[model samples]
Target: MTCNLAYNPRFMFLTKTIRYNLLAILACLLWSSSFVTTKHALDYQTPLTLAGLRFVLAGLIQIPLCGHLLAPLRMLRKEFFTVLLVSIFHTIFLYGTFFIGMTWVGGAEGAIMIGVGPLSSALMAHLFMHDDKMQRRTLVSIGFGMAGVVLISLASKPWSPVGLKEFFGLMLLLSGAVVSALGNVVVAKRKGGLHPIALNSAQMLLGGVVLLLIAFPFEGAANFALPPAFYGQLMWLAVISATAFAIWFHLLSKIKVSKLNLWKFLIPLSGATLSWLLLPDESPTLPSLAGMALIVAGIVIGQRESK
Candidate 1:
């Protein structure tokens, strides 16, 4: 005799995969638009203060939303300090430098430098972390990525006898990349994942405190008036922080981390496109477009071989 049993359909898994990738792309677009928003917001607020507020608000929003997922205080004791350290280095130091650098550099140049994140992350994985071993194809992919970086940097025109101030700006952004690389390695191969929401929230809180403390010393206290449009801008930034991170971390849970990373190639390309649309003076020249093509190609090759 035949018996019937309740079973979930296999297609559910396929549907989920599609949903995750869709969310990932949405996260990318939201994050890309941040470059433009930050540029606009800088007219009213100092970079450090703005960075501080962004994280503070993000943390506040996440606390009530994810508080239940955190481990008990005793269980978190050992990890508590480590999380704070990573937050300071990765979120505060890295973001602080990037914002300060933005004061001197355009969104286009910043996007190109930030686009090298995946390669930097890969190198960090190979050097410091276990279980994220570099494969031969990954190395080949890295070569392509490096070539793209060279082209993008050349297209950015950093050293055409500009003032020393411009060079310092580049240095700050490059430093931000190094810090972000370190964060990636620190996260790679971590056993028994922390609740992403809890972790991100705590770190953002700590980082915000640090950044805010630094803000006043650098920018001084200004009773600056806000334009009517700043409310819209701030709301956009808040949405970028909350929504992008929620979607990104959710995807990380559902998919292999390495596979999800491939979408990073789209970030700078999107940012470049946004800049082209927004800025009258700047557009993607042929070299910039070629650089983006190389980045995308490298990501595809890397993902195929990473398996």
Candidate 2:
């Protein structure tokens, strides 16, 4: 017997929309896990070195699948430059500050700060993109998400007589958020025929190379030796970076950036949970749990509104 629902165009569209939304959520989850993994990797390597190596590894992993060594050569000059701009904002500035900030802040704290990216992205999209204009519901969702982040940050005591290192870390994390939001706007604004995988690979490779070059002057290449555990963490970070960026860019190509970015509210929740489970010193307090609950609620509301 044929199912009438299967033949219904509206129903089919809804199913596909849900599938794409799920993909965005999955990407958020993968990205959220990075806070913890990056924190672990930082213990064995300097921030710049770790950032450079992680993305370089990720770019190498995606090379064959994206186009081996001929991908960038195939891109038009304009497209190549667009990808380079994306690499600058998204990889070099975003992750570079992120890794450095994580050195001073805890993984959970870093996650909360990064949680601000969704609101930033939404505002940027509304301002810059015609089709991504913000609605009442989006404003409400952003309010909820930002409130949750505020609650988490307060509960985490990020501002109670902040030291120099903590203050610098907070600034860096917020800067990363802004750069990341700008990158999302750039990607959404791009009208190109380049494959998403190719774009992702080129940006990561270029950004990684830039980071390594920057690292050479300040961090140097002397302390490259690390244990087996560090290598494992490095490989895992590479997998996470490659997979998450690919999924995220593909979703950005398909959907509204505002709607897609709403899923990033889950990052703090997931990152905090993972940090609690893995790092004994990073357990969340009761208020932090309440903040996480608000974050989850905000995500749910945003998801429903997106539909």
Per-residue lDDT of candidate 1, residues 1-307 (tens digit): 6533334455665566668777888988888889878888888888998888888777667766775635323223657775776686668989899889989875446665676666676666667755566677776776776677567656655545546786788788888877777765554434347666666677777787788889888777633478878767867786687677656655655554444655676777676677678778776778977987887787668656232
Q: Go through the candidates in order and give the C-alpha RMSD of each one to the true structure.
A: 4.0, 2.4
Root-mean-square deviation of Cα positions for candidate 1 versus the true structure, in angstroms: 4.0
Candidate 2 regions exceeding 4 Å error are 1-3, 67-69, 76-78, 107-109, 154-160, 280-285
State the lDDT at 169 in candidate 1: 84
Per-residue error at 289 for model 1, in Å? 3.8
lDDT for model 2, on a 0 to 1 scale?
0.81
lDDT of each: 0.70, 0.81
Q: What is the TM-score of candidate 1? A: 0.81
Candidate 2 lDDT over 1-307, as tens digits, reads 7779988998998899899988887888888777667767878898998899988889888877875577754542548778888898889999999888878875446656787899889888888899999888877887888778767766765555668998799889999898888888888776445677878888888888889899989998837567899999999999989999988888887888888898888777676677678877776888888887788777778778444
Could you tell me the TM-score of candidate 2? 0.91
